[model samples]
Target chain A: MTFFYISAAVALISSVLAISRSNAVHALLYAIVSLLSVALIFFMLGAPFAAALEVVIYAGAIMVLFVFVIMMISSGPGSTQQERRWMNFRLWIGPSVLSAVLIIELFAVISPPREPMSAKPVIESKQVGIALMGPYMLGVELSSLLLTAGLVGAYHLGKRKDDAAQTEDVTIHD
Target chain B: MTSVPAEYGLILAALLFAIGLAGVLARRNIIFILLSIEIMLNAAGLAFISAGSKWGQADGQVMFIFILVMAAAEVSVGLAIVLQLFHRIRTVNSDEANTMRG
Candidate 1:
Protein backbone atom coordinates (compact mmCIF):
# COMPACT_ATOMS: atom_id res chain seq x y z
CA MET A 1 0.00 0.00 0.00
CA THR A 2 2.88 2.33 0.71
CA PHE A 3 4.24 1.73 -2.76
CA PHE A 4 0.79 2.26 -4.19
CA TYR A 5 0.39 5.61 -2.48
CA ILE A 6 3.83 6.71 -3.49
CA SER A 7 3.24 5.73 -7.10
CA ALA A 8 -0.10 7.55 -7.02
CA ALA A 9 1.46 10.74 -5.73
CA VAL A 10 4.30 10.68 -8.20
CA ALA A 11 1.97 9.91 -11.07
CA LEU A 12 -0.25 12.83 -10.17
CA ILE A 13 2.58 15.32 -10.01
CA SER A 14 4.34 14.11 -13.11
CA SER A 15 1.18 13.93 -15.17
CA VAL A 16 0.18 17.43 -14.12
CA LEU A 17 3.57 18.73 -15.07
CA ALA A 18 3.58 16.79 -18.27
CA ILE A 19 0.37 18.50 -19.35
CA SER A 20 0.43 21.94 -17.75
CA ARG A 21 4.02 22.96 -18.34
CA SER A 22 4.78 25.33 -21.15
CA ASN A 23 8.25 23.97 -21.80
CA ALA A 24 8.43 20.96 -24.06
CA VAL A 25 11.59 19.47 -22.57
CA HIS A 26 10.17 19.82 -19.07
CA ALA A 27 6.99 18.16 -20.20
CA LEU A 28 8.93 15.22 -21.65
CA LEU A 29 10.84 14.77 -18.40
CA TYR A 30 7.58 14.76 -16.49
CA ALA A 31 6.35 12.13 -18.92
CA ILE A 32 9.35 9.98 -18.08
CA VAL A 33 8.67 10.32 -14.37
CA SER A 34 4.99 9.51 -14.87
CA LEU A 35 5.82 6.35 -16.81
CA LEU A 36 8.36 5.22 -14.23
CA SER A 37 5.86 5.57 -11.40
CA VAL A 38 3.33 3.43 -13.22
CA ALA A 39 6.08 0.92 -13.88
CA LEU A 40 6.70 0.84 -10.14
CA ILE A 41 3.01 0.27 -9.56
CA PHE A 42 3.27 -2.72 -11.90
CA PHE A 43 6.12 -4.03 -9.76
CA MET A 44 4.08 -3.75 -6.59
CA LEU A 45 1.34 -5.83 -8.22
CA GLY A 46 3.72 -8.79 -8.66
CA ALA A 47 4.50 -8.00 -12.29
CA PRO A 48 8.23 -7.54 -11.96
CA PHE A 49 8.92 -8.71 -15.50
CA ALA A 50 6.34 -6.37 -16.94
CA ALA A 51 7.61 -3.56 -14.75
CA ALA A 52 11.13 -3.96 -16.10
CA LEU A 53 9.88 -4.09 -19.67
CA GLU A 54 7.85 -0.95 -19.04
CA VAL A 55 10.93 0.91 -17.88
CA VAL A 56 13.20 -0.51 -20.53
CA ILE A 57 10.83 -0.04 -23.43
CA TYR A 58 8.75 3.01 -22.45
CA ALA A 59 10.91 5.09 -20.15
CA GLY A 60 14.06 4.20 -22.06
CA ALA A 61 13.27 4.16 -25.80
CA ILE A 62 9.95 5.96 -26.38
CA MET A 63 10.64 8.82 -24.00
CA VAL A 64 14.03 9.23 -25.58
CA LEU A 65 12.28 9.89 -28.90
CA PHE A 66 9.90 12.34 -27.21
CA VAL A 67 12.83 14.20 -25.70
CA PHE A 68 14.59 14.23 -29.05
CA VAL A 69 11.56 15.84 -30.70
CA ILE A 70 11.39 18.51 -28.03
CA MET A 71 15.10 19.13 -28.51
CA MET A 72 14.69 19.51 -32.26
CA ILE A 73 11.73 21.82 -31.92
CA SER A 74 11.74 24.84 -29.71
CA SER A 75 9.09 25.19 -26.96
CA GLY A 76 7.01 27.68 -28.91
CA PRO A 77 3.41 27.08 -29.93
CA GLY A 78 4.14 27.79 -33.53
CA SER A 79 1.96 29.86 -35.87
CA THR A 80 -1.12 29.68 -33.65
CA GLN A 81 -3.87 32.12 -34.57
CA GLN A 82 -5.20 34.23 -31.71
CA GLU A 83 -8.81 33.39 -32.66
CA ARG A 84 -9.10 30.31 -30.40
CA ARG A 85 -8.23 29.19 -26.90
CA TRP A 86 -7.86 25.85 -25.07
CA MET A 87 -10.59 26.58 -22.51
CA ASN A 88 -14.28 25.90 -22.97
CA PHE A 89 -16.91 25.28 -20.29
CA ARG A 90 -18.72 22.62 -22.27
CA LEU A 91 -15.76 20.26 -21.99
CA TRP A 92 -15.41 20.48 -18.20
CA ILE A 93 -19.04 20.10 -17.10
CA GLY A 94 -19.66 16.71 -18.66
CA PRO A 95 -16.47 15.03 -17.46
CA SER A 96 -16.77 16.58 -14.01
CA VAL A 97 -20.24 15.12 -13.48
CA LEU A 98 -19.05 11.74 -14.65
CA SER A 99 -16.10 11.88 -12.29
CA ALA A 100 -18.35 12.72 -9.34
CA VAL A 101 -20.51 9.68 -10.01
CA LEU A 102 -17.43 7.51 -10.42
CA ILE A 103 -16.03 8.70 -7.13
CA ILE A 104 -19.23 7.73 -5.39
CA GLU A 105 -19.02 4.29 -6.95
CA LEU A 106 -15.43 3.96 -5.74
CA PHE A 107 -16.42 4.81 -2.18
CA ALA A 108 -18.86 1.91 -2.28
CA VAL A 109 -16.02 -0.47 -3.11
CA ILE A 110 -13.65 0.85 -0.44
CA SER A 111 -14.42 -1.79 2.14
CA PRO A 112 -15.11 -5.12 0.53
CA PRO A 113 -14.54 -8.62 1.82
CA ARG A 114 -11.83 -10.11 -0.34
CA GLU A 115 -10.04 -13.32 0.55
CA PRO A 116 -6.83 -11.73 -0.80
CA MET A 117 -5.72 -14.83 -2.60
CA SER A 118 -2.18 -14.37 -3.92
CA ALA A 119 -0.42 -17.19 -5.69
CA LYS A 120 3.28 -18.04 -5.39
CA PRO A 121 3.60 -16.63 -8.93
CA VAL A 122 6.38 -18.29 -10.92
CA ILE A 123 6.94 -15.42 -13.39
CA GLU A 124 10.62 -15.01 -14.08
CA SER A 125 12.38 -13.28 -16.96
CA LYS A 126 13.25 -16.64 -18.50
CA GLN A 127 9.69 -17.97 -18.40
CA VAL A 128 8.48 -14.94 -20.32
CA GLY A 129 11.15 -15.39 -23.00
CA ILE A 130 10.26 -19.05 -23.40
CA ALA A 131 6.57 -18.32 -23.52
CA LEU A 132 7.12 -15.73 -26.23
CA MET A 133 9.12 -18.17 -28.33
CA GLY A 134 6.91 -21.17 -27.55
CA PRO A 135 3.46 -21.86 -28.94
CA TYR A 136 2.74 -18.19 -28.34
CA MET A 137 5.64 -17.41 -30.62
CA LEU A 138 3.25 -16.05 -33.20
CA GLY A 139 2.31 -13.20 -30.90
CA VAL A 140 5.96 -12.38 -30.37
CA GLU A 141 6.78 -12.30 -34.08
CA LEU A 142 3.71 -10.30 -34.95
CA SER A 143 4.56 -7.69 -32.34
CA SER A 144 8.16 -7.54 -33.49
CA LEU A 145 6.99 -6.90 -37.04
CA LEU A 146 4.69 -4.21 -35.74
CA LEU A 147 7.54 -2.61 -33.84
CA THR A 148 9.76 -2.73 -36.91
CA ALA A 149 7.12 -1.06 -39.00
CA GLY A 150 6.80 1.65 -36.38
CA LEU A 151 10.54 2.28 -36.45
CA VAL A 152 10.52 2.49 -40.21
CA GLY A 153 7.57 4.87 -40.19
CA ALA A 154 9.23 7.05 -37.61
CA TYR A 155 12.46 7.19 -39.51
CA HIS A 156 10.66 8.08 -42.72
CA LEU A 157 8.71 10.86 -41.03
CA GLY A 158 11.55 12.41 -39.05
CA LYS A 159 14.03 12.35 -41.88
CA ARG A 160 12.35 15.41 -43.35
CA LYS A 161 13.27 17.93 -40.66
CA ASP A 162 13.48 20.98 -42.91
CA ASP A 163 11.65 22.81 -40.08
CA ALA A 164 11.60 26.38 -41.35
CA ALA A 165 11.84 25.64 -45.02
CA GLN A 166 8.77 23.37 -45.17
CA THR A 167 6.40 25.98 -43.82
CA GLU A 168 4.46 26.03 -47.07
CA ASP A 169 3.81 22.29 -46.97
CA VAL A 170 0.75 22.39 -44.73
CA THR A 171 -2.00 24.06 -46.70
CA ILE A 172 -5.01 25.04 -44.57
CA HIS A 173 -8.28 24.48 -46.35
CA ASP A 174 -10.01 26.98 -44.13
CA MET B 1 -6.48 -7.33 8.35
CA THR B 2 -4.47 -5.11 6.02
CA SER B 3 -4.07 -1.36 6.12
CA VAL B 4 -5.19 -0.88 2.53
CA PRO B 5 -7.68 -3.06 0.75
CA ALA B 6 -6.63 -5.13 -2.23
CA GLU B 7 -9.17 -3.35 -4.41
CA TYR B 8 -7.27 -0.13 -3.81
CA GLY B 9 -5.31 -0.92 -6.94
CA LEU B 10 -8.42 -0.77 -9.06
CA ILE B 11 -9.44 2.56 -7.62
CA LEU B 12 -5.97 3.94 -8.22
CA ALA B 13 -6.06 2.74 -11.80
CA ALA B 14 -9.42 4.43 -12.21
CA LEU B 15 -7.99 7.66 -10.87
CA LEU B 16 -5.07 7.47 -13.26
CA PHE B 17 -7.46 6.80 -16.09
CA ALA B 18 -9.46 9.87 -15.17
CA ILE B 19 -6.34 11.98 -14.99
CA GLY B 20 -5.23 10.71 -18.34
CA LEU B 21 -8.61 11.45 -19.85
CA ALA B 22 -8.52 14.93 -18.43
CA GLY B 23 -5.13 15.45 -19.92
CA VAL B 24 -6.32 14.22 -23.26
CA LEU B 25 -9.39 16.48 -23.28
CA ALA B 26 -7.82 19.60 -21.83
CA ARG B 27 -4.41 19.70 -23.50
CA ARG B 28 -3.83 20.92 -27.05
CA ASN B 29 -0.16 20.11 -27.36
CA ILE B 30 0.35 17.07 -29.57
CA ILE B 31 3.17 15.71 -27.47
CA PHE B 32 1.14 16.21 -24.33
CA ILE B 33 -1.78 14.46 -25.94
CA LEU B 34 0.52 11.55 -26.74
CA LEU B 35 1.77 11.51 -23.17
CA SER B 36 -1.81 11.59 -21.93
CA ILE B 37 -2.56 8.64 -24.16
CA GLU B 38 0.32 6.87 -22.42
CA ILE B 39 -1.17 7.63 -19.03
CA MET B 40 -4.39 6.10 -20.19
CA LEU B 41 -2.52 3.04 -21.43
CA ASN B 42 -0.68 2.80 -18.12
CA ALA B 43 -4.00 2.95 -16.31
CA ALA B 44 -5.24 0.05 -18.40
CA GLY B 45 -2.06 -1.93 -17.70
CA LEU B 46 -2.42 -1.32 -13.97
CA ALA B 47 -5.98 -2.49 -14.08
CA PHE B 48 -4.82 -5.65 -15.79
CA ILE B 49 -2.22 -6.30 -13.13
CA SER B 50 -4.80 -5.76 -10.40
CA ALA B 51 -7.11 -8.18 -12.17
CA GLY B 52 -4.27 -10.64 -12.46
CA SER B 53 -3.87 -10.61 -8.72
CA LYS B 54 -7.58 -11.25 -8.31
CA TRP B 55 -7.43 -14.21 -10.69
CA GLY B 56 -4.11 -15.60 -9.42
CA GLN B 57 -2.54 -15.82 -12.88
CA ALA B 58 0.43 -14.29 -14.67
CA ASP B 59 -1.55 -13.62 -17.82
CA GLY B 60 -2.10 -9.98 -16.94
CA GLN B 61 1.60 -9.49 -16.33
CA VAL B 62 2.35 -11.08 -19.67
CA MET B 63 -0.22 -8.87 -21.27
CA PHE B 64 1.42 -5.81 -19.77
CA ILE B 65 4.75 -6.66 -21.39
CA PHE B 66 3.06 -6.72 -24.76
CA ILE B 67 1.39 -3.43 -23.93
CA LEU B 68 4.77 -1.93 -23.12
CA VAL B 69 6.13 -3.01 -26.47
CA MET B 70 3.12 -1.58 -28.25
CA ALA B 71 3.35 1.71 -26.37
CA ALA B 72 6.99 2.08 -27.33
CA ALA B 73 6.07 1.55 -30.94
CA GLU B 74 3.18 3.99 -30.63
CA VAL B 75 5.26 6.71 -29.05
CA SER B 76 8.04 6.42 -31.56
CA VAL B 77 5.71 6.42 -34.53
CA GLY B 78 3.50 9.11 -33.05
CA LEU B 79 6.24 11.50 -32.08
CA ALA B 80 7.97 10.97 -35.37
CA ILE B 81 4.79 11.89 -37.18
CA VAL B 82 4.40 14.87 -34.90
CA LEU B 83 7.94 15.90 -35.64
CA GLN B 84 7.43 15.59 -39.34
CA LEU B 85 4.16 17.47 -39.20
CA PHE B 86 5.80 20.22 -37.25
CA HIS B 87 8.52 20.45 -39.81
CA ARG B 88 6.08 20.65 -42.70
CA ILE B 89 3.44 22.82 -41.06
CA ARG B 90 5.86 24.45 -38.62
CA THR B 91 3.34 23.87 -35.86
CA VAL B 92 2.81 20.97 -33.46
CA ASN B 93 -0.59 22.18 -32.29
CA SER B 94 -3.43 19.75 -33.09
CA ASP B 95 -6.31 22.23 -33.13
CA GLU B 96 -4.79 23.92 -36.14
CA ALA B 97 -4.24 20.74 -38.15
CA ASN B 98 -7.84 20.36 -39.26
CA THR B 99 -7.18 20.39 -42.98
CA MET B 100 -8.48 16.85 -43.30
CA ARG B 101 -11.56 17.31 -41.11
CA GLY B 102 -14.83 17.90 -42.96
Candidate 2:
Protein backbone atom coordinates (compact mmCIF):
# COMPACT_ATOMS: atom_id res chain seq x y z
CA MET A 1 0.00 0.00 0.00
CA THR A 2 2.81 2.38 0.77
CA PHE A 3 4.33 1.43 -2.56
CA PHE A 4 1.07 2.32 -4.30
CA TYR A 5 0.97 5.71 -2.66
CA ILE A 6 4.56 6.38 -3.61
CA SER A 7 3.88 5.37 -7.19
CA ALA A 8 0.80 7.53 -7.31
CA ALA A 9 2.67 10.56 -6.05
CA VAL A 10 5.41 10.04 -8.61
CA ALA A 11 2.91 9.64 -11.44
CA LEU A 12 1.01 12.74 -10.43
CA ILE A 13 4.08 14.93 -10.21
CA SER A 14 5.48 13.77 -13.54
CA SER A 15 2.18 14.22 -15.33
CA VAL A 16 1.86 17.75 -14.04
CA LEU A 17 5.41 18.48 -15.13
CA ALA A 18 4.80 16.81 -18.45
CA ILE A 19 2.36 19.53 -19.35
CA SER A 20 4.00 22.49 -17.61
CA ARG A 21 7.52 21.93 -18.96
CA SER A 22 8.51 23.97 -21.99
CA ASN A 23 11.07 21.56 -23.39
CA ALA A 24 9.27 19.00 -25.53
CA VAL A 25 11.81 16.24 -24.90
CA HIS A 26 11.71 16.88 -21.19
CA ALA A 27 7.96 16.75 -21.30
CA LEU A 28 8.15 13.37 -23.01
CA LEU A 29 10.59 12.10 -20.43
CA TYR A 30 8.18 13.16 -17.71
CA ALA A 31 5.34 11.41 -19.48
CA ILE A 32 7.47 8.27 -19.56
CA VAL A 33 8.04 8.44 -15.80
CA SER A 34 4.37 8.93 -15.14
CA LEU A 35 3.59 5.91 -17.30
CA LEU A 36 6.10 3.74 -15.48
CA SER A 37 4.65 4.81 -12.16
CA VAL A 38 1.17 3.86 -13.25
CA ALA A 39 2.58 0.52 -14.34
CA LEU A 40 4.06 0.07 -10.92
CA ILE A 41 0.70 0.79 -9.37
CA PHE A 42 -0.78 -1.99 -11.46
CA PHE A 43 1.87 -4.37 -10.15
CA MET A 44 1.15 -3.46 -6.54
CA LEU A 45 -2.55 -4.02 -7.12
CA GLY A 46 -1.88 -7.67 -8.06
CA ALA A 47 -2.59 -7.28 -11.74
CA PRO A 48 0.76 -8.39 -13.05
CA PHE A 49 -0.70 -8.93 -16.49
CA ALA A 50 -1.81 -5.33 -16.77
CA ALA A 51 1.47 -4.26 -15.24
CA ALA A 52 3.46 -6.07 -17.92
CA LEU A 53 1.28 -4.67 -20.68
CA GLU A 54 1.61 -1.20 -19.19
CA VAL A 55 5.38 -1.37 -19.24
CA VAL A 56 5.67 -3.00 -22.64
CA ILE A 57 3.12 -1.08 -24.61
CA TYR A 58 2.90 2.38 -23.09
CA ALA A 59 6.41 2.76 -21.68
CA GLY A 60 8.31 0.73 -24.24
CA ALA A 61 6.69 0.74 -27.68
CA ILE A 62 4.60 3.94 -27.89
CA MET A 63 7.25 6.10 -26.23
CA VAL A 64 10.00 4.82 -28.50
CA LEU A 65 8.10 5.99 -31.57
CA PHE A 66 7.38 9.31 -29.90
CA VAL A 67 11.08 9.90 -29.27
CA PHE A 68 11.85 8.75 -32.78
CA VAL A 69 9.40 11.20 -34.31
CA ILE A 70 10.80 14.02 -32.22
CA MET A 71 14.32 13.24 -33.38
CA MET A 72 13.35 13.09 -37.07
CA ILE A 73 11.62 16.42 -36.89
CA SER A 74 13.25 18.56 -34.19
CA SER A 75 13.76 18.86 -30.43
CA GLY A 76 12.12 21.27 -27.97
CA PRO A 77 9.60 23.98 -28.75
CA GLY A 78 9.78 25.71 -32.09
CA SER A 79 9.89 29.54 -32.22
CA THR A 80 7.95 31.12 -29.33
CA GLN A 81 4.80 31.12 -31.39
CA GLN A 82 2.22 32.85 -29.20
CA GLU A 83 -0.72 32.36 -31.50
CA ARG A 84 -3.61 32.13 -29.03
CA ARG A 85 -5.50 29.73 -31.25
CA TRP A 86 -8.55 29.17 -29.04
CA MET A 87 -6.53 27.54 -26.28
CA ASN A 88 -9.35 28.40 -23.92
CA PHE A 89 -12.46 27.75 -25.91
CA ARG A 90 -15.88 26.24 -25.19
CA LEU A 91 -15.00 23.26 -27.35
CA TRP A 92 -13.38 21.55 -24.37
CA ILE A 93 -15.34 23.05 -21.52
CA GLY A 94 -18.40 20.89 -21.97
CA PRO A 95 -16.38 17.69 -22.31
CA SER A 96 -14.30 18.53 -19.28
CA VAL A 97 -17.36 19.06 -17.12
CA LEU A 98 -18.81 15.80 -18.27
CA SER A 99 -15.54 14.04 -17.51
CA ALA A 100 -15.51 15.53 -14.04
CA VAL A 101 -18.96 14.15 -13.42
CA LEU A 102 -17.82 10.75 -14.59
CA ILE A 103 -14.92 10.85 -12.19
CA ILE A 104 -17.22 11.66 -9.32
CA GLU A 105 -19.48 8.80 -10.30
CA LEU A 106 -16.49 6.45 -10.27
CA PHE A 107 -15.59 7.62 -6.81
CA ALA A 108 -19.07 6.85 -5.56
CA VAL A 109 -18.96 3.41 -7.09
CA ILE A 110 -15.60 2.45 -5.58
CA SER A 111 -15.81 3.92 -2.07
CA PRO A 112 -18.22 1.50 -0.48
CA PRO A 113 -16.45 -1.84 -0.45
CA ARG A 114 -14.00 -2.49 2.36
CA GLU A 115 -13.58 -6.21 1.88
CA PRO A 116 -10.26 -7.87 2.56
CA MET A 117 -7.97 -8.55 -0.36
CA SER A 118 -8.69 -11.77 -2.20
CA ALA A 119 -6.35 -14.71 -1.82
CA LYS A 120 -6.34 -15.76 -5.45
CA PRO A 121 -2.93 -15.40 -7.09
CA VAL A 122 -2.23 -12.90 -9.82
CA ILE A 123 -3.82 -13.59 -13.19
CA GLU A 124 -1.41 -14.21 -16.04
CA SER A 125 -1.51 -13.35 -19.71
CA LYS A 126 -2.65 -16.80 -20.70
CA GLN A 127 -5.99 -16.26 -18.98
CA VAL A 128 -6.35 -12.90 -20.67
CA GLY A 129 -5.46 -14.38 -24.05
CA ILE A 130 -8.23 -16.91 -23.77
CA ALA A 131 -10.76 -14.24 -22.84
CA LEU A 132 -9.84 -11.84 -25.63
CA MET A 133 -9.18 -14.33 -28.41
CA GLY A 134 -11.91 -16.80 -27.57
CA PRO A 135 -15.04 -15.04 -26.40
CA TYR A 136 -14.13 -11.47 -27.30
CA MET A 137 -12.45 -12.08 -30.62
CA LEU A 138 -14.83 -10.22 -32.90
CA GLY A 139 -14.41 -6.80 -31.36
CA VAL A 140 -10.67 -7.25 -31.24
CA GLU A 141 -10.57 -8.18 -34.91
CA LEU A 142 -12.55 -5.11 -35.90
CA SER A 143 -10.22 -2.88 -33.91
CA SER A 144 -7.24 -4.49 -35.62
CA LEU A 145 -8.76 -3.81 -39.01
CA LEU A 146 -9.40 -0.26 -37.97
CA LEU A 147 -5.77 0.10 -36.95
CA THR A 148 -4.61 -1.31 -40.28
CA ALA A 149 -6.72 1.17 -42.20
CA GLY A 150 -5.41 4.01 -40.11
CA LEU A 151 -1.84 2.93 -40.79
CA VAL A 152 -2.44 2.72 -44.52
CA GLY A 153 -4.06 6.14 -44.60
CA ALA A 154 -1.25 7.65 -42.56
CA TYR A 155 1.29 6.10 -44.89
CA HIS A 156 -0.45 7.47 -47.94
CA LEU A 157 -0.62 10.94 -46.47
CA GLY A 158 3.02 10.88 -45.33
CA LYS A 159 4.55 9.42 -48.49
CA ARG A 160 4.21 12.40 -50.88
CA LYS A 161 6.80 14.61 -49.19
CA ASP A 162 10.15 15.19 -50.91
CA ASP A 163 10.97 18.61 -49.52
CA ALA A 164 13.07 19.78 -46.56
CA ALA A 165 10.79 22.53 -45.23
CA GLN A 166 7.96 20.12 -44.43
CA THR A 167 8.10 19.86 -40.66
CA GLU A 168 5.26 17.77 -39.24
CA ASP A 169 5.62 14.02 -39.74
CA VAL A 170 2.27 12.78 -38.44
CA THR A 171 -1.19 14.11 -39.33
CA ILE A 172 -3.91 12.80 -37.04
CA HIS A 173 -7.25 12.04 -38.60
CA ASP A 174 -10.55 13.59 -37.71
CA MET B 1 0.11 2.24 8.91
CA THR B 2 -3.04 3.44 7.18
CA SER B 3 -2.77 2.47 3.55
CA VAL B 4 -4.70 3.97 0.70
CA PRO B 5 -7.36 1.74 -0.75
CA ALA B 6 -7.80 0.83 -4.39
CA GLU B 7 -10.58 3.40 -4.59
CA TYR B 8 -8.05 6.07 -3.86
CA GLY B 9 -6.22 4.84 -6.90
CA LEU B 10 -9.36 5.62 -8.89
CA ILE B 11 -9.19 9.20 -7.76
CA LEU B 12 -5.55 9.24 -8.65
CA ALA B 13 -6.39 7.79 -12.03
CA ALA B 14 -8.96 10.50 -12.59
CA LEU B 15 -6.43 13.13 -11.71
CA LEU B 16 -3.80 11.63 -13.97
CA PHE B 17 -6.29 11.38 -16.80
CA ALA B 18 -7.19 15.02 -16.39
CA ILE B 19 -3.56 16.05 -16.44
CA GLY B 20 -3.15 14.20 -19.69
CA LEU B 21 -6.14 16.01 -21.09
CA ALA B 22 -4.62 19.30 -20.05
CA GLY B 23 -1.40 18.32 -21.76
CA VAL B 24 -3.21 17.49 -24.96
CA LEU B 25 -5.19 20.70 -24.74
CA ALA B 26 -2.55 23.20 -23.68
CA ARG B 27 0.48 22.00 -25.62
CA ARG B 28 1.11 22.76 -29.27
CA ASN B 29 4.02 20.41 -29.81
CA ILE B 30 2.98 17.26 -31.68
CA ILE B 31 5.30 14.98 -29.72
CA PHE B 32 3.93 16.35 -26.48
CA ILE B 33 0.40 15.91 -27.69
CA LEU B 34 1.08 12.27 -28.50
CA LEU B 35 2.67 11.84 -25.12
CA SER B 36 -0.39 13.35 -23.52
CA ILE B 37 -2.65 10.91 -25.30
CA GLU B 38 -0.39 8.11 -24.11
CA ILE B 39 -0.84 9.40 -20.58
CA MET B 40 -4.57 9.42 -21.01
CA LEU B 41 -4.59 5.87 -22.30
CA ASN B 42 -2.41 4.60 -19.51
CA ALA B 43 -4.53 6.31 -16.91
CA ALA B 44 -7.62 4.58 -18.16
CA GLY B 45 -5.72 1.30 -18.20
CA LEU B 46 -4.66 1.81 -14.61
CA ALA B 47 -8.22 2.41 -13.53
CA PHE B 48 -9.30 -0.75 -15.28
CA ILE B 49 -6.67 -2.97 -13.67
CA SER B 50 -7.16 -1.54 -10.20
CA ALA B 51 -10.89 -1.90 -10.38
CA GLY B 52 -10.64 -5.36 -11.83
CA SER B 53 -8.31 -6.56 -9.11
CA LYS B 54 -10.58 -5.10 -6.47
CA TRP B 55 -13.53 -6.91 -8.01
CA GLY B 56 -11.70 -10.17 -8.69
CA GLN B 57 -11.88 -10.37 -12.47
CA ALA B 58 -9.40 -11.12 -15.23
CA ASP B 59 -11.31 -9.19 -17.86
CA GLY B 60 -9.42 -6.06 -16.97
CA GLN B 61 -6.14 -7.73 -17.61
CA VAL B 62 -7.43 -8.89 -20.97
CA MET B 63 -8.62 -5.43 -21.87
CA PHE B 64 -5.20 -4.02 -21.03
CA ILE B 65 -3.47 -6.35 -23.48
CA PHE B 66 -5.61 -5.08 -26.32
CA ILE B 67 -5.02 -1.56 -25.17
CA LEU B 68 -1.29 -2.23 -25.28
CA VAL B 69 -1.50 -3.53 -28.80
CA MET B 70 -3.51 -0.47 -29.83
CA ALA B 71 -0.96 1.79 -28.23
CA ALA B 72 1.80 0.14 -30.21
CA ALA B 73 -0.10 0.58 -33.45
CA GLU B 74 -0.97 4.17 -32.65
CA VAL B 75 2.57 5.28 -31.81
CA SER B 76 4.13 3.50 -34.78
CA VAL B 77 1.72 4.84 -37.35
CA GLY B 78 1.39 8.13 -35.56
CA LEU B 79 5.15 8.72 -35.58
CA ALA B 80 5.39 7.62 -39.19
CA ILE B 81 2.85 10.25 -40.10
CA VAL B 82 4.62 12.78 -37.90
CA LEU B 83 7.86 11.97 -39.64
CA GLN B 84 6.21 12.47 -43.01
CA LEU B 85 4.45 15.61 -41.84
CA PHE B 86 7.77 16.96 -40.65
CA HIS B 87 9.32 16.07 -43.97
CA ARG B 88 6.68 18.03 -45.87
CA ILE B 89 6.00 20.82 -43.40
CA ARG B 90 9.38 21.08 -41.58
CA THR B 91 7.42 21.90 -38.46
CA VAL B 92 5.80 19.74 -35.77
CA ASN B 93 3.60 22.40 -34.26
CA SER B 94 -0.11 21.69 -34.67
CA ASP B 95 -0.81 25.39 -34.98
CA GLU B 96 1.50 25.66 -37.98
CA ALA B 97 0.30 22.65 -39.99
CA ASN B 98 -2.53 24.20 -41.97
CA THR B 99 -1.97 22.39 -45.26
CA MET B 100 -5.41 20.77 -45.13
CA ARG B 101 -7.99 23.38 -44.34
CA GLY B 102 -11.49 22.56 -45.40
- TM-scores of chain A across candidates: 0.62, 0.65
User: Could you give candidate 1's per-residue lDDT for residues B1-102 as a string of tens digits?
Assistant: 233344887887898888889988998889889888988888888888777766656667767767777888888889888876776667888987766525
For A1-174, candidate 1 gives per-residue lDDT tens digits of 544575677777677767777756556666777777776666556667887788887888777877677657664555232113323444344334433443343343243773332333535667656766775777788889988998898788777556544454643411
Model 1 lDDT at residue A123: 54
- lDDT for each residue of candidate 2 in A35-61, tens digit (9 for 90 to 100): 777766676666777766777877776
Per model, kept true contacts as a fraction are 0.58, 0.64
What are the C-alpha RMSDs, in order, of all predicted structures? 9.3, 10.6
Instruction: Name the docking class for model 2.
Output: acceptable
TM-scores, all candidates, are 0.74, 0.74
Query: Residue-wise lDDT of candidate 2 within B6-98, one digit each (tens)?
Result: 688788989989998998999898877888888888888878787777776778777776677677667667777777667656678989787
